[model samples]
Target: IGLGVIKNVTLKSGEVNGLKISEGKLAGFIRIRDSGKAELTAIGKFVNSKFFHHLRNSLILATLTVFLTLLFVVPAAYAFSRLKFFGREHILYFYLMFTQVAGGLGIAGLIALYGMLVKLGLYNKLPALAIIYAAGSVPFNTWLLKSYIDSISPDFDEAALVDGASYLQIIRYVLLPMALPGIATVAVMSFIGGWTEFILASLLLTEENQPLSVWIYTLMGGIGRGIDWNYFAAAALLFALPVFIMFMLAQNYIRSGLTVGGLKE
Candidate 1:
C-alpha cells in the first residue's frame, strides 16, 4: 500500500481520527522532494537567476580583471625580467610578503574591506569589485608572469631592440607572443578570482546582483541539517558548470604555462 501510496499523492495526510489516511498533493510533494525531482525544480530556478541576474556583473568583473591584469602585469613582468633597475629584487620581496599578509587576513579583513567600500560609496558596484580583483591579483600575476618571462633569455628582448623595435613594440610583438601560455594562465586565475569569490561578492552585491557563489552559500542557510540538500546540490552543480567547462577548454594552455612557469619558481 505504501508503494501505491507513494504513487498517489494522498499518503501525505497521516491517519485521520487515528484510522483514515489519504495520500494527496502533500504526499506527492514529500515523495518528490526526497526523490530529487524537487531539487531539480529548484535547480532550474537557480540557473535562471544566475543567467538573468548574476551573469551580467560576474562577466563584467571577470573580463575587467583579466584585461587590467594583462595590461599592467605585462609591462611590470617585462621590466622585472629584463631590466636591472635598483630595488627590483626588493620589490619582488615586498610582493611575496604582501601575498602572505593578504592570505592571512581572513574574514575580518574581508568585512573590513567591504565596510570601507561602503564608506567610499563603492559597495554594490560591479566595477568597483573588478578594480579590487585586478589590484589584488597584481602581486601574484606579476610574480608568475615575471618568472615565466625570465625563463626566456633576455637575448629575446635584445634581438627585438637590435631590430630597432621600441620597448613597447618588443613587448607587443616579441615577449607577449612567446609568453602566451603564461598570460592565459594569469587571465584564468584572475577570472576565477572574480567568478568564485563569495564573501566579497556577498557583501558587495545586492540581492538582485548576487552571483553563483552567493547563491550556493545562501540557498540552504544551514549545513548538514535544516537544509534542502537537493536544491543546494543542484545550485552547486549549476554554479560550477561554466567554470568547469572553461577549465576543460583551458586545460592545455594551463599545462603549458605550469610547465614553463612552474620550474622558474
Candidate 2:
C-alpha cells in the first residue's frame, strides 16, 4: 500500500512550492509503503514460534553466566591486583596463555567437552551451559578487572586495614564501588558472549533448551528448504535488540572502564 499517486507536474527551475519527482523508473521504490501487515505477520510468527521460551532460556544463561563470572573474577582479580604470592606473575601469565590458546577450544576440544558434559548429565542443562560460558569468560574478565583494580590506590586498603577492616570489608567497601565501571564492562561483555554464543549452545542444548541465537539459525531453513528473508531478518533484528540496548545503556561505563583498565597507574 502506498500513500500518494505519482503524477507528472510542470515546475520552473528553483520553484520552491513545486513537488519535484524523479524522472527515471523507480524499481522497488516505495514512496510511502505500509508494511504493517508484513511486520505484524512476522511478529506474530515470532510470538507463536516459542521465541519467548528461547528468550527466557537465553536470559537465564546470560544472567547466570555473568553472575558466575563476577563471583569468581572479583576476588581473583583482587588477589592478583593486591596480594603478593609465589609465582603470582607466572600464574597471571598462565591465565593469559590459556586465554590466548584455548580461547576457541577448537573442534576437538569441543568434542571432548561434549563427551564430558554428556557423562556428567550436563547436556541440555542451562545452568551447566552457563557454567561453561562463565568459565570461558573468567580468564579474560579477570585480567580486565585486575587491570582496573590495579589502577585503584592501595592507600584505601591500608586505611581500611588500619581500622581493623577485613579483606572482605575492604573489597566490599572500597574496591567494589571504585571498580564498578570495570565490573559493568565485564558484565556487559560476558552477557553478550553468553547471549550470542552459538556453537556451544547448539552442540550442548536440545531444541527445548535452545537460545534465541540457535532459534534464529533454525529460521534459515534446512535442507531443501527456502528461506523466508523477511521473517528471518525480523527475527534477527529482534534477537540483537537486547544486546544493542544493553550496550547503549552502558556505553559510558564501558568506555571509561576500558580507558582506565587499559592503563596502569
Candidate 3:
C-alpha cells in the first residue's frame, strides 16, 4: 500500500485490535509516528537538521575516496601484474598484506592516526578524510585488481607495446576496458566504505561536516532527552537508500569480478 493511502485510512476498533498482533506491530509503530517536523519533534531543533547537507558531504567524501583509490590502485596493480622487479612478489604479498592485517589494530591505530591528522592540520577536513579512506582501501583493492589483471593474457600488453603504446597508453586503451568489472567492484566497495563508516567519521568530523552516518547519531538527542523513534527511522532509511540502490545495480559485476579475479591466483 502507498504511504499516503495508508495515512488517510482510519482503522476501525476491530482492526486496531487486530493490528496489536505480532505480525502487525511494525505497521502499528510506523502509523503512530508523526512526520519529522520542527514543531512536532526534536529532530527539527538543530540548525543543520537538513539531511541534504549531510548527504552532500557523504557524496563528496565517497566520490573523492573512489577517485583516489582507483588512481592509485589501477597503476599499482598494473605494475604488480606486468613488472619483473626484484622483491615484487615479496612486496605485494608481505608489505601489502601487512598493511591489510595491521588495520585490525583498530582503536589503537585510530588514536595514532587522529594525532597525525591533528599535527598535519587535516582534522575535520573532507578531503583528508577521503585520503584516509583511500589509504585504507589501497592494499586490498590493489591485490584484487592485480589478480584480475593477471587473468588477462600478457599477449595484449605485448601487442600494444609492439604497436608503440607506452605502459600508460596500454593501461588506458587495453587493460582498463578488459578489467572494468574489477574496477567497478573496487569502486563500489570503496564508495560503500566511505558512505557507511561511522566510527572514524564520528571522531574526525564536526556537525557542519557530518555525513549521514554520523548525523543519525546526533538525531538520537543528548542525555535526558526522549528519543524520537520516528525521526531516527526516517534518517536511517535515507542513509541506507543509496547503498541499497548501488548494490542492487552492481551485484552482477561484483559477483563476476570476485569470481574471475580469484580464478587466476
* lDDT comparison, 2 vs 3, better candidate: 2
Among residues 3 or more apart in sequence or in different chains, the pairs in candidate 3 whose N, CA or C atoms overlap within 3 Å are none
Ranking by TM-score: 2, 3, 1
- The lDDT per prediction is 0.71, 0.79, 0.76
Error of 1 at 255 (Å): 8.2
Q: Which stretches of candidate 2 lie over 4 Å from their true place?
A: 1-40, 104-106, 252-265
Name the top lDDT candidate: 2
**What TM-score does structure 2 among the candidates reach?**
0.79
Model 3 ranges with Cα > 4 A deviation: 1-48, 248-265
**What lDDT score is found at residue 54 in candidate 1?**
64
Q: Write the per-residue lDDT of candidate 1 for residues 131-228, one digit (tens) a residue.
A: 88888899999999998897787777777777798999988877776787788788888888888888777777897777767766766676575775
What does the lDDT read for residue 12 in candidate 1? 52
TM-score preference between candidates 2 and 3, better one: 2
Residue-wise C-alpha lDDT for candidate 2, range 107-212, written one tens digit per residue: 5599899999999998899999999899989999999999989889888788788889999998897788778788988999999999999999999999999999
RMSD (Cα, Å) of model 3: 9.4
Against the hidden reference, what TM-scores do the models get? 0.73, 0.79, 0.75
RMSD score of candidate 2 (Å): 11.9
